[model samples]
Target chain A: MTTQDTTYLDQLEAEAIHILREVAGQFEKPALLFSGGKDSITLVRLAEKAFRPGKFPFPLVHIDTGHNFPETISYRDKMIERLGEKLIVGYVQDSIDQGKVIEQTGKNASRNALQTVTLLDTIAANKFDACIGGARRDEEKARAKERIFSVRDEFGQWDPKRQRPELWNVYNGKIHKGENVRVFPISNWTELDVWNYIRREKIELPTIYFAHQRDVITRNGQLMAAADFLNIDEHDRIEHKNVRFRTVGDMTCTAAVESDAFLIDDIIEEIRSSKISERGARMDDKVSEAAMEDRKKGGYF
Target chain B: MDLLKFFTAGSVDDGKSTLIGRLLYDSESILADQLEALQQSNRKNDDGTIDLAILTDGLKAEREQGITIDVAYKYFQTDKRKFIIADTPGHIQYTRNMVTGASNSNLAIILVDARNGVVEQTIRHSFIVSLLELKHVVVCINKMDMVDYSEQTFNDIHKAYSEIATKLHLNEVTYIPVSALKGDNVVNVSGNMPWYTGKSLLDHLETIEVNEDEKSPQARMPVQWVIRPQTDELHDYRGYAGRVSSGSFHVNDKVTVLPSGVRSEISRIETFGQDQAEIHSGMSVTLHLKDNIDISRGDILVNSSHEPIVSQLIEADLCWMDTRPLDDSMMYLIQHNSKQTKCKIREILHKVNINTLDKIPADSFQLNDIGRIVIKTADPLAFDLYHENKQNGGAILIDSRTNLTVGALMFRASVE
Candidate 1:
């Protein structure tokens, strides 16, 4: 083995691993919220480092928005199969069928916001005391002020003003029976840091993360993948373009960036010099300046 | 390249947000979309530039109030090094937030407005940096343009701060004149400050060697989880899972499980399905012991030679975070590393008056109060002094009823 000093990536990985173990040790019933995104995939790798030679202390739970990319769902299944871990899926369609949430009706409608109800339901049904997510602080401004172990009320609501102070490396993961905590292991990692870590670990992701030929339509200056899930106007012109996804979510809301950066190295370079923030590709955040904060306070994962 | 995780202590009035905004903006870390949004917003500088503070005032309430209420972490990187800034508010009531941010920082950036040299707020921030024992301190004398770029103004503040630094025993202090609003001495060298021979803030930040690699020689790894795959292929595979907080652990090393003090030998060190002869600090790995004892979660494994002090009574300094005052009768749950146990405040020594460096005798502490207190834990805790080893010495107090973290404890010693 060659000797190399610990880099920033290693430091981040170590911190994340420590956090994962803390979740395991603190909570009785914890779940990993997986969306098959690059961030969740990174969390899966960290969970392996945190708990190996033993079945994971918790199963992976996915709150399916039902408008998700088919690639992400398939990738999620196969990855869980390979890791020999359990996966629990909560579908937004089921929540709609049960009258727990109403489906928005519009050409720009999306099931993204509706996923929070399904997620909260899934948590209560499973009695999960802690739900570990791949939320990063650098992704949004309100998230920048979040604690590593953020406590949520019985309704899964986040109170920005009433957050507990996180000190040193010591985390206090105490909650009532109904109250739960939203644990973010990668709370300190930036988008670039996540990309660099993916490169270093050679972590494989869904094919959509890399560049490929896809049918797309430009709407509000965003190149959206022309999927059936999205309400495509017949008069809208669909164009074939080479693009990759900077972030993965509901196909109706997630936008793609025009790039030929198929390889991980190329993707890193593309992200390094890219002018637009990664969340700029998402249409949901375009709704308002405080869209993310509002959703978070309303129990959006 | 390595990472520098520093804490910046200042309010918006001192141009702290402007300095941070300049660092991120000039480094090209702030993307076009964010900048475009800022430009589109109504908030702007007096001269019609985008109000950079708008970018960091994250919460809507904070934005509406024109003040920071909590600690916000921001990350930016240069070609030389990556950085994580624990940006905290510098208000008198926000001292707890500063303590929270400074606990994890290797360096402190104390922003001082040139017009108001050595103010009360300056002394308060300095006291926190000193209390946290941060080795590297950078005193940025900001708003140089407002002061007409006067070298005398900078020198006067520098001299005034030097006296404070000497009293606080802040090591490796550097003073730099900056105009965060005018982009002077922040990202690049400013032509206006020709007499200022020191490097710009960004340059100094990139080149400073914080020596973060030099962890304490004593090994400490709090056992987080146990891996016992009952599958056919890996039976009898009892592995202790934990991250090495300090020093290193190697195969055949004599180890002792803390709180139980059971002696054992390290049989194997494994990480990511590979066997390793040794694991260093900041590594997440599992170890197989030669003789399995009654080791449970929250047990710390250490080198047998340098055992941690195990005791039921602890003398510590607590920075209160909760709005509720300290109730000695209430049983608080103390979380140290992965361990959790009930604790109570046995005695209150005194509260440190941050501005005056005076220890006022007190028996109670309210929000944002820093005071020494003795704690009685339900179980014996294995730990070191906070100054000697931060990883094992720091803990958090959680209110049993509210389940909110109420105080941050930095252990001084174990008492009878």
Candidate 2:
């Protein structure tokens, strides 16, 4: 036996793998929530390390808002195919078509809030007892108060005041019928940590994460990706800009930052010295002060 | 860079949140948008200063009530190391939250109000820090500016805290005079306090050596999941997966499964589809034994030479965290690592009043009460003492009816 020094990244990875294994071990039915973003992609790599050689004990679940960047969906499909794992997608458009949720009208309308219905429906349909998410506490104020094994009621509501006390490394995953847990493997990780881990592990991400030329329109001082789903008015001016997304969400709500960070190293450096948070460009959260908390209480991942 | 996790605990008015805000602000860890939000928030102090407490009190209810309801985890990093700060609440009712925060922390910062000196909350936090067996503690005597940055006030508070520390068996205690509001002696040394000679709070935190406890030399890996690929390319692959809880396991090392006491030799160590010669503590990997033995989740794989105690009856100290008191007639689920079993509270030995550090006779425990109790389990469990190894020794009690985690238990001994 020799004394080995573990780096900060190694420790974080070890903690995440441990959590992933715990979710697999404790819950009878678990699924990894894949968003094709760097965080969830890092979760995929960690899951591979957690239970590889053998198939993942759980499948991957993705709630498609139908307003996502096509590149992200393609990346998600390719990764799932490469891993030889099952991917379950719950489409928000189906919910809207089925009258389960109503699509918002006019400007600032997005499928972001409607994703909660699709996600909850998917969880109930599949009876997933635990859903592994890539949410980090450093991302938002509401996230900072969450437990690793956050339990949701039959209605999929998160009661912030009544969270289970998580002690040591032991997470209490015990729940009755109809109750499910949201497991966050990287709750302690920050935005910089995720980018650094992606850089270290050389995990592939969507091309949109890198600086590329794309048609964008400025709204409310934010650059929104000019996608077909986005209802751009005749007065709205569209321009092609060299930009990259800090976070990937519904194209209607997600915003981009001007940058030339083409490589992972450049992105890591950008994050290390960047003034804005990863969630700063997220237009959905700008609706209210407690927007994330309100959405989380309603089962939005 | 290395990682260090610490938590801060003090009374409501002790400026715990302010100290945390100062740390983040001084380190440049607070982002521009977050700072802008803080500045724009309606909640402001009387002095027109941005209420840093709002930064940690995330929930609407907490902000409305001007209190912290649960533990809020914050992350930051310096050039030398990364830090995870569990900014726990200060209210007495939120003791469970503080316990949760302190359980995984390597160090604790117990804030002391210089004007008030050592109070009941300070003693309570100290007892919790000691009860959790944290290796390090920092007593940041804050609000020194209110006391005119006087060395005499700092010395008086230090003396009072040292007296309380003696009763709590706290050996590693560092005292620093600080004013969280004035930003004195928090991140940088204070020129005002010329008489005081010690590292500032942040400087000390950056330089402190968090030595990892020596591994027991006996490996313990609780089987978390069993993997069988059953692939066409590889016909038969049976692997037992878990994180190495303690020590290290080498390929071909003789091991024994707990309870069943099945013996086997490690045939291979696989991690991420690659075989490794050995794996150490905290590494999550799969192990394939040479011989097939009945192994399942909740079973522990230990070095054959050093086996843990397997018993049905155990005595432990439990911190009750539920509204309803512990009932002797009701059954609770005791979960240790991956193992789960039905347990009954045989007897309540004693409960300790954290403020006074006195053992009081009690039949049942209510919210935020720590008590020693004897538990009788339906089946035997493999475990080590909490002081010996935290990962293997700690357990939680889940209410069978509500399914809420009610108590945090640390095994004291196997009741004969």
Lowest summed lDDT across 10 adjacent residues in model 2 chain B is found at B209-218
DockQ each candidate and list the results: 0.78, 0.71
Model 1, residue B181: displacement in angstroms?
0.7
Q: Which parts of model 1 are misplaced by more than 4 Å?
A: A2-4
* For every candidate, C-alpha RMSD to the true structure in Å: 1.4, 1.5
List the global CA lDDT of all models: 0.89, 0.90
| Candidate 2, residue B328: how far the Cα is off, in Å | 1.1
Q: Which residue pairs in model 1 clash with each other? A: none
lDDT of 1 by residue, B287-405 (tens): 88999687888889999988999999999988888899999988999998888999988999899887788999997889999989999999999999888888788899999888888
Misplaced by over 4 Å in model 2 are A1-3
Write the residue-wise lDDT of candidate 2 on A203-256 in tens digits: 889999999999999999999999877888897899999999988888998999
Chain A alone, TM-score per model:
0.98, 0.98
